[model samples]
Target: MNLLKSLLIVVIGILPFVVNAQSNNYKVRKCFGYQRDSCTTSANIFYKLNEDSRSALFVKGQSSQTIVSIYNGRDYRISLCWDHILGNRMGFKILDRETKNVLYDNSTDEFATDFEFTVTQSRDIIVELSIPGESTLSKSEGNEELIIIRKDKEMGCVGVLIEHMITPTKGF
Candidate 1:
């Protein structure tokens, strides 16, 4: 009985780590899409695994945000990608941390998949993601309700790709 109890405790403790490891792999795959190496070569400022700006899981119609520091005089390319199975409706926005000003909203730009810009000052900015809700439709020529659902649970992996925009050196 004591041995069983010990094994049970060990399994319970390791469960979360295993789940998270799987999630990270899924998220990374989703991020790069068909071009796995694109993310690596493009991102000079990659976020660490399980870090604030790395990845997240969310259901449809949910919104989440993270803060990442941006340096002055350096341009950045902020890109967002999600589980392709979930469709292309996922996107993110950039907000100024201190004043809360609306810096960039993807929705306003027709849900752009990526954004590039240079910050004048160094500070933390909020990166907010939005996932559209699942669509529901009434059955045609039938009284039964029709609902579309994924084979897997309604969870999505969002990856924020942060790439540094290198500047060209000017000859004096």
Candidate 2:
């Protein structure tokens, strides 16, 4: 019994370090922040959204702030799951390059759904998501990255740890 207890204690002590390990992604351009042993995802990921910049839109009022910059004719999807129910609020400012007009600006509100967007130009872009300091964010800001760029009194408090940017290699 004594020997068994000693082994168990050692395993428990090393578990935290074993868990809070480095993460990697093939498409992760920049890893700005990180945290471990917090949420179900195990690790939070932040990547630079620079691939497609022309067609940019900020994903406002989301559990995870999803900022995506994609070129013309590319399909992208972002999925964010929280420990608790997330407030459904997201807005988009889709720009029309040729006319240089605000084509579609809609606030996306849903209980929990996979947000999707398509870029229409090969230009630089910006997308942002915001989450309220509610239930889902009960734990510490384990690992988060808030983009320094703020527009028109916009304060960023979105703790979106994981993000994925999808780009189309061929076909213009």
Candidate 3:
């Protein structure tokens, strides 16, 4: 009986950690492919969705990059979407992977969330995305309790939608 009681106590002690881990996994699963359908709908008729289109959990003030191949003779549209908690004006840029040149920067276009352009030459490009705001756990905040609460509330989903279609040939 004493052994059983000890086992029960141990299980009770470990329950919270198990539950917390499950909840974290659930949050990530909920964000996965979040914008796949909604973002692609805008390009459905003219463009086919590229496999590289994806969504991920993001926190304010975080930045990430993904590389994608752009084929020559194709027109592509790139769109960005996020949970409103992350706010608007998220930064988006396209850089040439080999030359590292900034091919395009949304900042100059009033932080446009979507861009469409034709690829003249096949190449790999880096798409960089940045969420707006200061880090959620900034040391300046100092309040541990507030930091914990803010971290949960500030996390959100960010999606990049890439669509492509053959560049239409000029008039015959």
lDDT of the candidates, in the order given: 0.65, 0.38, 0.82
lDDT of 3 by residue, 1-172 (tens): 9999999999999999987544257545756776684464553587888888988878787789999999999999999988777886799999999999999999998999999999999999999998888664533446546554364567777889888999999999
Candidate number with the higher lDDT (2 or 3): 3
Q: Please list all clashing residue pairs in model 3, or write none if there are none.
A: none
Task: RMSD for all candidates, in order, please.
Answer: 10.5, 11.6, 8.5
- lDDT digits (tens) for residues 81-147 of candidate 1: 6765557676678898999998999888988887878667899999888787652321233456665
Model 2 / residue 25 / CA error / Å = 19
* Residue range 66-116, candidate 2, lDDT tens digits: 334455665444333322222334333445444546544445344233345
The deviation in Å at residue 64 for candidate 3 is 0.5
Model 3: what TM-score? Answer: 0.75
lDDT, model 2, position 105 = 42
Candidate 3 Cα outliers beyond 4 Å, as residue runs: 1-28, 137-151
Q: Candidate 1: lDDT of 145?
A: 61
Worst 10 residues of 3 by lDDT: 135-144
Which numbered prediction scores highest in TM-score against the true structure? 3
Using all chains and alpha carbons, the TM-scores for the candidates as numbered come to: 0.59, 0.35, 0.75
